[model samples]
Target: MKRIESEQNASIKQWKKLYTRKERDKLGQYIIEGPHLIEEAMNHNVQIAHLIIEESYQMPHDWEQLRLDPWVVSKKIMGILSDTEHPQGVLAICRMSSKELQVKAGGKYLLVDGVQDPGNLGTIIRTADAAGLDGIVLGEGTVDVYNSKVLRSTQGSLFHLPVVKGNLQDWIAACRQEQVPVFVSALKGAESLHDVQSSGTFALVVGNEGSGVRMEIMESADQLVYIPMFGNAESLNVAVAAGIMLYELQKNRK
Candidate 1:
């Protein structure tokens, strides 16, 4: 094991760059803090490049059996590497998966379009995982899936499922070619979500919090659906709506 006490250490500097999306994309790596996320990555077989722990933090004995060599750093250095206000004292640098996700026949997926909020995107991902969806395709204008806040919000579900970036138009086309129904959520001129029978195989498209799905994309959907609002409030949050829709679609699936 190596020890890093200085904040100016070269490795520390490089890992700190992971806080930015550009650096994560350029290096094809991202950082996940907290022991739960790290353990989740290990459990899911996500490639972990490095394990970092603050010198004062006590690691569980089981972690010692892992193949990874831990690097002990001072709390000060960990603070620089941590994204959270309260540092968990543990973090891992992980390599991005290289596997390409294809939209296959009879598979379920969530097509996210222009969702700018990190928390919402993360929740959507976690919900999709719980719903037993095959994968998530992030459409253009969506926030970077590797964003720290987004990663934290996923609570390690990011490691449980495949999340890839792609063009919604092409994905929609591919789903249709495979005979998978494409359902886009919309505020107007749409079928109530309750009325549509769950096909067990589908691609549900959700969109920006403010504007909702793009008009052109909505027009391209095999069906447009909306949740019936019984409350006095205007509408559901994107993530909440997605959870409701995904569960509805998945409950009847074999």
Candidate 2:
């Protein structure tokens, strides 16, 4: 294991740059902090480029057996790398998967559009995984899935399934070719979510917090469905609405 004592270390400088989306994309890697998320990455066989630990922290016994060859860094260096106010003493730089996912018949997916909040995007990913969807499609204008807050918000669920970034229109076109139904959530002129019949194989589209789904995409949906509101609340948070719709759709899956 390497011991890195200086914040000026070349590797540490590069790792710190990962905090930016542009740098992360350029490097094709992202940092995940906390023991739980790192463990999930290992369990899921996600390629971990570096396992970093603060000098004072003790690694778990099981982890030591894996021979990860972690870099031991001073507390100061860890603090510089950590995104959280309270550093967890451990984190990793993981390689991004290069696999491309396709939208096909007989599979269920969640399509996100223009969700700018990292927490919302992460929660949507977590909810989709919990609901047992095949995968998630992050449409253009969605927040980067590798954002630190997004990674933390997912609570390790991101490792459980494929989350692909792609063009929504292309994905929707593919879904149509596969004879899969596409349901877009909207406010006006949309059927109540309870009134729509899910065919077990469909794509559920959720959109921006302020503008809702784009009119062009909504118009392309096979059905536009909205959750019935009994209370005075005008709308649901995108993540909450997604959770409700995902479970409801999954409940009737064949």
Candidate 3:
């Protein structure tokens, strides 16, 4: 296997480029740092461009033989490329696959509207994947999915779901094209989340943690739903809200 000891190596520069959204978009590639995420990506047959491993990580006795032929690199180089202070020593660059955004009429989907935090975005994606939602629609102003922290938080769920992204109005137009009902979540006066009655497919819109859904989108929603909070706190985290809502939506799905 090749070794990337020099920080100045061309490949190192390319691997480092995965840190920025522009570079990730330009190349359609993302970096996974933790060993578990890397293994999941490999096992799922995601397209891996390259992998970097630190010699000090000491190959596992059982895994050394079957894992991909990884390039060994110095710890300093890992520090330079990894976003985390404590680098996982094993990082892999993988390509992003295309996802379908449009849903069939009355189909199920989760719309992440204007979410900005990478960690929240990642957790939401992981939760949505686990809930068996058809896919995720990341509306405008959402965090970059390829952000190192977000990708790490997803724990490789990014590979499992169909994640489509666009502006609020544009996604709404696309949903209309598919005849899917849009359910927006709001803090006040909205019906309880479980009260919504739907015919076929539906898209749940969970907005930013601070602002909630935009006024325009809320107006367009077929129905607005609110989660009842028993505690003094106003509401739940976006990811937590997503989990509750998804469970409510798919409680009886086969």
The TM-score values for the models, in the order shown, are 0.96, 0.97, 0.89
Q: How close is candidate 1 to the true structure, as a TM-score?
A: 0.96
Give the range of the ten consecutive residues with the poorest summed lDDT in model 2. Answer: 245-254
lDDT per residue for candidate 1 within 135-244, as digits (tens), equals 99999999999999899899988888789999899999999999999999998899987788876999999999999999999989988999898989889999999999
User: How are the candidates ranked when ordered by lDDT, highest leading?
Assistant: 2, 1, 3
lDDT of 3 at 54: 85
**lDDT (tens digit, per residue) of candidate 2 on 7-122:** 89999999999999999999999999999999999999899999999999999999999888999999999999999999999999999976567777898989999999999999
Among the numbered candidates, top TM-score falls to 2
Report every candidate's CA lDDT.
Answer: 0.91, 0.91, 0.82
What is model 3's C-alpha RMSD? Answer: 2.6
Q: Name the regions of candidate 2 deviating beyond 4 angstroms.
A: 252-254
Error of 2 at 253 (Å): 5.7
